[model samples]
Target: MSSKIYSVITGTGIYLPKKKVKNEAFLDFKFFESNGKPVERPNEYIVDKFQEITTIQERRYVADDLVASDIGFFAAKKAIEDAAIDPETLDYIIVAHNFGDVKFGSNRSDMVPALAARVKHKLKIKNPDCVAYDVPFGCPGWLQGMIQADYFIKSGDAKKVLVIGAETISRVIDLHDRDSMIYADGAGATILEGKESSSPVGILTHKTRSDTYRYAEMLTMGCSYNVTEKNKNDLYLKMNGRRLYQYALETVPLSIKACLDKAGKDIMQVNKVLIHQANGKMDDAIIERLYKLYEIDEVPKGVMPMIISWIGNSSVATVPTLLDLILKGSVENQEIKPGDLVVFASVGAGMNINAAVYQF
Candidate 1:
């Protein structure tokens, strides 16, 4: 009989930029009507609306000279230290991002120099055998990278992998668009180690699905759906909030339930449900729906922890950053213990959705 080799998440780290921008900061920003005419809403009214929808009161922004990979490297360093693993001992370095190395305050990105490679160089890892790569799987990128690391461990292709999700998404948001209120900037990371275990623990089950066929146009960049010409060349992100909210409320819960079912567990066994910190209200509604699927009437507090109120959605970086904060006790009264069941889930840009069941 062969012993099971489990991929365990040994450590986690996150990096938030120094600058914080309050919701009130957007008061002077103009909002346009469908006809391109400026809306007449008061500044306080707009700020309150944003708070009601996203539950986000502020978000961080990177310095104008910094890039996504720079923050990623910082998070990775802390994760490696937390794991007590030598950087040169890592077998693979996987970076998950959407805009690549997006320079703060600019739409331009330097993709030729891959973000993973940049992180490796910044870490001063000397081993040529420590292969590095990137995964651009929308906002679910970090969770997906963790899934891929599990695969490598199971296949005996790698013993240790470093996975990071980082982004300067604020650089991609259209300041004139309301969607900008939901986007921010940050980075997070984890180290996965392969170890032989007697029990069935670590990453148990995971599933990913995309609805690009029907919803590809629901969220996108480089122009609005019906408008063109000057806006055609615009490179900022634009989303149909109504469609996105509807899709998330319907799809994300099913994905979580399906993933837990595959692991031979029920919702009652879950200790924590760490979802992508997208919108405060939308996330709350999704969790409420999840409880209903199991026929539970009420959604308990502290079961799902939220950081979006202080740090808006940084795309791929959301999950890991939230996890790290909770684990470190930075978020009061929330913690993950050994042998606890933790379910991770997220949905975003590709119209891609994913969930995973893990034993911590």
Candidate 2:
């Protein structure tokens, strides 16, 4: 019998920006409501509340000299080197980002040639056969790109693909919004190489669902909450935090369960759940509910290794960054080995949620 082919994650890398933004950084900034009203609370009290919920004490921010694609290239380079493959050998370069490259001090998004193409150029790969493109699926973009790479490999259309998720949320946030503290900048990349085997070993099953009917506007771009601001062309990332939290808790767990079931694997069989680091508290709730779906009471310790407390939420970059960190033993007490069953899941803008179950 002919063996089936699958795309497995063979190498991973991440680029963390040099600037570390602490919660205290916003102490002097005036926060306001969407309706042009002051928050009325002291900055310290607000910061404390934000930390209690998101658990993000600090997050990385790119230097003014860098942007999303810059970091994406850095991460892609490391992943390519880690895989120890010539860049020209890659069949595809898929970059996952929302705003392309929002330059420092500029609210504009620039993606004329596409970020993937830029990364390809930066990598200096001369192969014309290598296809490069972008995936704009919000926070789940990286995993979605991975799924696409798997399909390309499964169809015998590609051999090795680079999937990267890089975002600079810091550049698109309204300074007056307390939720801005949750934003950060970073990039992560994964190298997926195709392999044929007698049995399935990589990218077993995945699922995705979009809730645009009622949740499309949960996270959107809007003018600064600081009504006194003069610049109208400047847009910032905005969110209805209350609704987003409720939506994620309700759907993210179910999406993960469905993916595991499709893979014929249960929650207990999984060693890790690398979920998007949006809110630490919300992630904990999602896992708790995920365990409850399988009639389990307590979530296994170390099943989900988190970096949000120190990395904040870098939109699409979170999951891949977490995976890279864990694989390199950078995440304390969190590690994965050969044959470990793992799950990657995320929820973000588009009201989108997705999960992929794999055997590592």
Candidate 3:
């Protein structure tokens, strides 16, 4: 008999910094323009593009003093509380981040273990059995982490899994670069517990696609083979926006359709569509194309687009943060119904795209 693993999102939480950065604020910043000259703020362009595509007003980030893990801690606390599961019961903690707390030759492999210990200590969980590790992926980290946790839970290796996607993309960005304007920092967490039911409310199907050739289209770090002694700014998120847009527009629809097909579901059956929140314009263009191509009526609505405008892209944390906002009644009185199919999709710097279907 095949062992069954039912993965359910028992709890969800997110953390953002107290500071708020508005579109108008960008105009005042010296770095917004070249040679210290004032230039038209990019916020208007972003907003107009986003509003046409997504339903988002604001996003969040981490405070100046805090790192990605700090935000992760806050989100984890909320998820654990929501699940009513003690920290002591958690058998494993998986942290997903592309931007970790590594600086100039010093590594922080202990970061996850330290975070787990802190949570365990604060909760006063005596002699709790918990192991912590980190998983790094450009954008699919969160969903992939969920899949990893599901394997352990289904195999009876772990009773509970605390999975978090946290990122401090802001730290890696060269503030002078225009790309920095679209990067932010935040964290989100989910609690996964084993269930006896064969059917689960989370992670029904997941599909991943990567075109390694296009990997160079959006890269940060320099490769060892082609050693070019560039400045520090070269080590930031760089992208051929047009190429990425083309690839995403072409690939995402098929990927989403394939996932739904694998799950034996239809596009119209889905209630909400949650993507990586890459940008407002790109998302809108894809949605428009999908509608035209599929000829599907009643396209799902009320997506979180403004979050990217306000908080920029928080890398791996984007989806979970948006989910937290939706769950916490931040999505303008929208109610999630039973059997509602929610789609999670992401496209990131790896030239990687993934789509997963979840029913709740």
What would the TM-scores of all predictions be?
A: 0.96, 0.98, 0.81
Candidates 2 and 3 compared: the better one by TM-score is 2
Top candidate (TM-score): 2
| Predicted candidate 2 versus true structure: per-residue lDDT over 214-317, tens digit per residue | 99999999988875447666788899999999999999999998998899997888999999999999999999999999999999998998999999999889
Alpha-carbon shift of residue 97 in model 1 (angstroms): 0.6
> Between the candidate structures 1 and 2, which one is better when assessed by lDDT?
2
User: Against the true structure, candidate 1 has what lDDT?
Assistant: 0.90
* lDDT: worst 10-residue window of model 3: 223-232
Question: Tens digits of per-residue lDDT for model 1 on 228-250?
Answer: 57555658777888999999999
lDDT of 3 by residue, 41-68 (tens): 5656744444444343454545656766
With a 3 Å backbone cut-off (N, CA, C), the pairs that clash in candidate 2 are none
Model 1 TM-score, all chains together: 0.96
Ordering by TM-score: 2, 1, 3
Better of 1 and 3 by lDDT: 1
Model 3 regions lying over 4 Å from their true place: 1-4, 29-59, 102-129, 198-200, 222-234, 297-300, 303-306
The lDDT leader among the candidates is 2
> How many times do residue backbones clash in model 1?
0
